[model samples]
Target: MTTLSDQDRARIAAAITEAEKSTSAEIICVVTRSSSDYWAAPFLWATLVALVWPWPLISITNLTASTIYLTQLVVYAVVALALSFPSSRRMSLTPSWIRRRRARLSAREHFFTQGLHRTVNRSGVLLFVSAAERYAEIMADDSVSVKIGESAWRPILDALRGALARNQLADGVVDAITACGAILAKELPPRENDRNELPDKVIVI
Candidate 1:
């Protein structure tokens, strides 16, 4: 769930109006599925070993365990470095979408996500990020042109579109920007796997 301020939502409505006329601005909102998995497969095993090995220092075997601990620490450090530099997901917030989303989701749920979505008042640009769940989709306004797959984006869009048609400018802003594009899906069919595949309801966002 998102929680953006009302002022930001107003700004987004302004931005969306600006976007409709500007063709150069390619607004891309990517909702990546299973996207933010930072825990490497080996992370848990290494951490467990490190925690257990430090207590029994008297045994000669504990000396070997210390070596294991150092190795584990190094590996974890390396992975952390990689994530901080290269693997971190770009988290952007459509302030209006946040406010709109908050109507549907809780604040604690969106805690770790880094918010970067800022409407540049008619300035054409792009915004992309990976979200939760296991699917993604692209929309051209209220109409979803490309159903990439099911993910957090789908549900979010559904809510946004609902808000739009009803003339709810706040939540409608998200729908205003999200349009169809090259969708990356992994085996999950957009319709069959979708959790919120309601008919296109522009007023629901």
Candidate 2:
């Protein structure tokens, strides 16, 4: 697993600080282990396997009802425990689309939770990452989004995706912030009295 060190955190914070110099945009960066626990995945898979394991015993074995029931219980317990592991839950059991969707929702939630929406000019941008899902999103408040349009963010998101793939998170975030700063500078130049409405440090969860 790629881990974000303290050094990476500091670098990310510096990037955000530097990026905000020319633009009034308040950029908040967040990184999370995962968007969701996906507790249902293990149980759902275990249930399906356990349900079929007993049918084989019922058809060909001489086992009594109580014995078969106990066997099924053991199967369910073992399968569920195995799948409960973090790697197992993320890689094999959970669907890709579901993981992406959960990450998307989480990014949106953090956009508001981080107070990015409350900036005076609504010039707030959220850079969110879900490590387990390998997902990244650039969420801008209405003012920025309206001025730049959503498609303008595709290259930024692509850069983020590639960085996540290579486990170069700090570099990716720095690049993303710099790119976002350039756009914001052109379309939403810093106001004379503008002040940071969000934290410059990277939020890790």
Candidate 3:
């Protein structure tokens, strides 16, 4: 799993504080090791191998049915163990589309789960990253999108994607938060007596 050090977390938190100074939109950053466990990949591989292993033995040898069944169980166990050793390999076995879909779902889940929708002006933004899946998304509430349009987020997404490709998550998130703040500040600006409706911190899960 990938993680940021204490200094990295502090840096991100400070960036959020600085960005929110000019905009009413509440910005939140979230980083996670993966979107899902993807247990199906290993299980599928083991099942396929075990199913085929007994067929060949049945055709060539006179092994008893019970013995062949036991061997099949052993084969499944061995293959599962082999695939389980390194988590990276296990993730690779999963189809790319599945991983991306799961990551997208998780990002949406976090947007609501973190109370981004509960803000007073409906001006919350979430920057989400799933390191293992190499996925990132920027979600904004209806108020911001209605004023500035979702296309405004394209540049931020591109910057973040490049950073992730180079394995620089902390820098990417900081830059993204700054960019979001600028856009929000221009369109929404801070209301008179606007108070923070959400905590300014980096959330890891």
Candidate 4:
């Protein structure tokens, strides 16, 4: 979990302002700490570690049944506690498909939560980044999607991922927003009466 500083927030807000200048589409940026807690993986691993404790006691040591059971209980408790640490819990042990599924679901939730679905022209675009999962999603409202194919978003996502990998999250977001704005500007130019429909500040979760 990286937290954006006030300077980073200001830059993103400026970028949003610049991006919306020529487009009716409202672009909302959201960066979440994670997509999922992924507690099951750590719990499963701890259980497996605990199950192996009885083997060594039965084969190499002359421990009594009660003692072995108590030792196993301790092992389970210790292992679970160790795995519960933030760094250990954040391991990418979840399957790729699961990560992708979770990220997509989270993005959809934010889409409606951020009012992208209710934009007057149906041209809201959401650039969602999940730091824990290393996933980025570009979701657009119906009007924008109808004009720009899904494949067109791939490059923008790739750029964002690259920036995140380099620990340049804010930069990645600004660039992606700028790229998306260009597309939206071309496809859905601002109307004479176009008004800012959403907050320009970046949302952190």
lDDT of 4: 0.89
Write candidate 3's Cα lDDT for 16-135 as tens digits: 999999988889888989998887888899999999999999999999999999999999999988887578878999999999999999999999999999998899999899988878
User: lDDT of each prediction vs. the true structure?
Assistant: 0.35, 0.88, 0.89, 0.89
- State model 2's lDDT: 0.88
What TM-scores do the predictions have?
0.25, 0.94, 0.92, 0.91
Give residue 192's error in model 2 in angstroms: 1.9
Model 3, clash count?
0
Candidate 1 structure lDDT: 0.35
Clash count list over all predictions: 21, 0, 0, 0
lDDT of 4 at 170: 91
lDDT of 2 at 106: 99
lDDT by residue for model 1 (1-205), tens? 2333567455554454434332322243322222333444334444555566555654545467567667657766654444443333212211334333432232222211222122222211222222332122232221122323336356655655555445453444454354321231221223322222111112111
Q: TM-score for model 4?
A: 0.91
Task: Decide which is better by TM-score, 1 or 3.
Answer: 3
* Tens-digit lDDT track of model 2 for 1-205: 4778999999889989988998888999999988988888999999999999988899998999999999999999999998898664545588888888899999999998999988888888999988877799999999898898878888999998899899887888889888988888899888898887888999999
lDDT of 2 at 132: 72
TM-score for predicted model 1 compared with the true structure? 0.25
Ten-residue region with minimum lDDT total, candidate 1: 196-205
**Compared to the true structure, candidate 3 yields what TM-score?**
0.92
